[model samples]
Target: MSRWSSETSKKFILVFVFLFLLYGCATAPVTGRKQLILVDPQTEIKLGLQAYEEILKKEKLCNDPTINALVQRVGMRIAKASGKNYDWEFKVIDKPESINAFCLPGGKVFVYTGILPVAQNEAGLATVLAHEIAHAIARHGAERMSIAMVAAFGEVLAAELLDLNNSRTRELFMAAYGLGATVGLILPYSRKQEYEADTIGLYLMAKAGYDPREAIKFWERMRQAASGRRKIPEFLSTHPADGKRIQALKNLLPQVLPIYEKAEHKYGLGEKIPEPHCR
Candidate 1:
């Protein structure tokens, strides 16, 4: 068979698989956003649990009872509000220099000790935890994977059409595909996921009895902390800029405030999260 004909046949198969997957969609909880999801819930959960176990074995876990108790308290409250039926587990990772936190698909949450200082108190921590939980509940990673599959298939189709054989062709193909996905597809969705996580997280935190207003304060502190370092301009960055994020939170307050007001056991700005004794 001619190279052109052979490549065209394979390209047709990739297109079919791509469209088949796109047809399988799921709506995200809380936000009700229609997400293009191709992965099975059970598979995603198993992968999350596997990764959680692997990370636990590799990373230094904070054995401080006080911090663990606090993380469990905040994590459980938000998880309950999120209405996820998974076996939720929260752990404090002893990474004092890395200010980060995240939730895996099956409700495993990890908080870095570094972010604790920025969190300052229980309410601030609630903001961070809730946001991470929101991402998991929304299956943002799966949505991205779905998008990535489409992008990859498109790249394959392009490669087949070009039928280039030089080593430089490989380099150009990588550059074109990476830049295209970054600029045209993935980054925008990442920013959207952040905003959705923020919105849903605010509601969850408020419903869990932590004052939603504290989120704005936490983000203000985050902005100040980030200001000391150089940052990629907002347009080029995956996350919304500090000013924009805080404003978005402020704008959302009107919607979440009533939920906060009605919370039966409000812990507005809770107590300070004393310095990590484990570090």
Candidate 2:
């Protein structure tokens, strides 16, 4: 009975915070999906701009003219297709060891040079850039911060209910909230966001005259590259397994393919990116 009462109290606290987040709902730009965005667009944009500045200060900008031109060409096409009048900028980071790329809110895109090998052509690069840009337009970052706040609220409630002074009890509270909220609520939400990004990215890339089918090829290459790496359990992972992601993209192709077929320029694979002797 004692344990049951405590469990019930925890549930009530989580529900309350969850409902609070729901009150600040916003719709995602491309998909029109309703999302819980605790932060306003202005605030999100401000934070993103600040973060982007900080990142630029820390990371060396790639001085390769060829790489810069390639990213700019693909990026501008996608940005125009998005139909959002964001002050957009595309840049390449000089990090050869990092396999990551991202777009900050309002369209600051930073691509790592290391990813160039994997994104062997313009279409492949389009897939990467478009997906990252999708995350920004979808306002996934705001939604994630909102969820994290709710998770933090749960921790506070647990601390009040349990004996915070006890080390064992503190451990229990931390582990329960940290692992449960992150792996349970956040991971599933992120997977959903990831799929949404893929869908929107296909549209943007196809509309930008890049081949949408190349997204699948890019992911297959990503899957192969990631094969030997240790994977987080699917239920606890933020991103879906590469195979699952590719399958979902395949299902969505019927919708995205027509957009590609009708594109005015239809630069199929566009230009082949030069093999990096930087490798």
Q: When superposed on Cα atoms, how far off is each prediction in RMSD?
A: 6.9, 7.5
Output the number of the TM-score-best candidate. 1
Superposed by TM-score, candidate 2 places the C-alpha of residue 253 at a distance from the truth, in angstroms, of: 0.7
In every candidate, how many clashes are there?
Answer: 0, 0
Clashing pairs in 1: none
Q: What tens digits encode model 1's per-residue C-alpha lDDT throughout 1-279?
A: 899877876876766566556546788777788877655566557656666776688789998999999989998989988888989999998987766777878898888898898899999999999987887888776666555545655344532322334333233322222222212432334668889989999999999999988899887777666666575322223444477888888999999999988987888888889778885
lDDT digits (tens) for residues 1-279 of candidate 2: 699778976786766565556447788766789887555566557656765676788778887788888899999999998887999999898876656677877788988887787788999999989988888888777677566545665354432323324443323322222223312333234667888989899999999999999999988776665566575422224344466898999998999899999998899998888854332
Which TM-score value belongs to model 2? 0.76
- The collision pairs in model 2 are none
| Local error of candidate 2 at residue 96 (angstroms) | 1.8
